[model samples]
Target: MIDPILPFSSYSEEINSMLPETIQKELVFLIDSDFMDWKKIESILKKFPSISHSIVRRRLDVDFGRLSRRLTGKSIGVALSGGGAKGFAHLGLLKCFEENEIPVDMISGTSAGAIMGGLFAMGLDSSDILPLIRNFWLDRNLLGDFTFPFVSLVRGKRYSQAIHEFFKDRSIETLPIPFYAIACNLTKAERKVFDRGLLWKAVRSSTSIPGIFPPFAERGELFVDGGLLDNLPGSILKERGAGILISVDLGGGGQIDKDEMYHNLLGPHYLGEAPSFFNLLFHHLKRKL
Candidate 1:
């Protein structure tokens, strides 16, 4: 029986292998956007500006037989947390899940977590996505340092554009698994689960870190990274009736204090002047931070 959650009729080779084929590249079914010549939801909305929400829902509804079968009596949910570069570590954790044959019936994530989680839900295995991450992140042309001073320097255009390109051909409904990308509406001071709209847009919004990246705009509304409010959305998954909720938190501070620190550089209300040389050195380090 064919799993119908995804349009497998449209699947092509997602991973290719030459030797040690079984362990290296397995046949993974995924929907091909180019094969379908899919148009972005944004483009479709523009073409039919007056289209009703119900119509949009109808158009976005995908056949979910496969996913339904997997979730027959289970309510498994996986929630990925926000942790900039630490997401790679989270990816490793996901790889562990795969090795253990754990089923992620539904998924939600924020920031880098959202990006990786989205890819996994779209039928890309960790092996398939590892190369994409390496190529994109290691490309000097894409991540090179910027020129000009007096600004944040990382204006985030390159990364933001990359995000758009990745999802230019897909929508949320096409995900191979149940998916949700979490973002925040600054104006509303709340977390938003983007279960609709363009997949790339949701990913973009989920990664729009406050100072590091610009906000995402949709129909003139502004959205920033969901990490700003709810990074590990276990509550959201629980609210959705998740039977087994697995949350991967990157520990907001990303550090566990060892109870071994006993020094305050500039003591609690210090008014003393340090040596000129030491002050200059500390100031230099401060600027770097």
Candidate 2:
């Protein structure tokens, strides 16, 4: 009944005529950005055109809004941080929330935090995801940008594909709760939000740890990890109107050892000689390696 890859061109004429001016403009953006193909948009439009159409259903639906208000009536936001495998610590944190009967209204994440946040937004229990991560081997999952780099052992699209398998036919907007990834544009030294397009693409961008995983492109913009700009994204959740914020720390602080920074004495791809300022700073930052 629903297909994510359905092409929009199939019913283009029918939809273009019916959609309002504002929605048409939005759809144009989605189509142009490769976020939603024409067909998938058509499928959604055909089923759920507007809130006006769902009014009858809304009337018949149980007014859980009243029940929700009766029970504390507050929104809680969860913020997750990036730390590669260190992010697994969030499972224990999320479990604590579950045991405490705290509810999550929205989620914001960066880097590996994006993976955990995305799955949770898709309605997967933290317990359900634990086994998946435990069985996952980082080296076997993704192959990086080029074959020559040891990073080539990181297979990005494969990870994206596996995520699609678990979160089939769901994009960012379709998730049960509002979820977003913070990604940094290395070229601009700016922080950006991944709210549109493929959830995996955004997750990939958020998790793209510069030299570790290659940059991801979305709508013609390149994005690396959000940690580059806002490593701790507590402020991001606050901006999103979180009534209360719960932060799960999966990060560490330690002294950087310069000797371990060099890989085979090649200076981590000879980045010291690179022209970009980011590359230069990257070399220094990798001192902690």
Q: Looking at model 2, which ten-residue stretch has the lowest summed lDDT? A: 51-60
Local distance difference test scores for all models: 0.61, 0.58
Runs of candidate 1 exceeding 4 Å displacement: 1-73, 140-152, 253-289
Against the hidden reference, what TM-scores do the models get?
Answer: 0.64, 0.63
Give residue 167's error in model 2 in angstroms.
3.9
Clashing pairs in 2: 6-39, 7-38, 7-39, 8-38, 8-39, 142-154, 142-155, 143-154, 143-155, 144-154
Q: Candidate 2: which stretches are off by over 4 Å?
A: 1-73, 138-146, 150-160, 163-169, 252-289
The prediction achieving the highest TM-score against the true structure is 1
Q: After superposition, how far is residue 127 of candidate 2 from its true place, in Å?
A: 2.0
Candidate 2 lDDT over residue span 1-289, tens digit each: 1224555465456555676757622221112212334344435655444421100112312223322422343557788877666778777777787788666777888877788888887656778888866665453445433444544335456666665665455667655456878887755557788754567777878877655565776667778777665555667767755667777656432111121221222233554564443345455445433
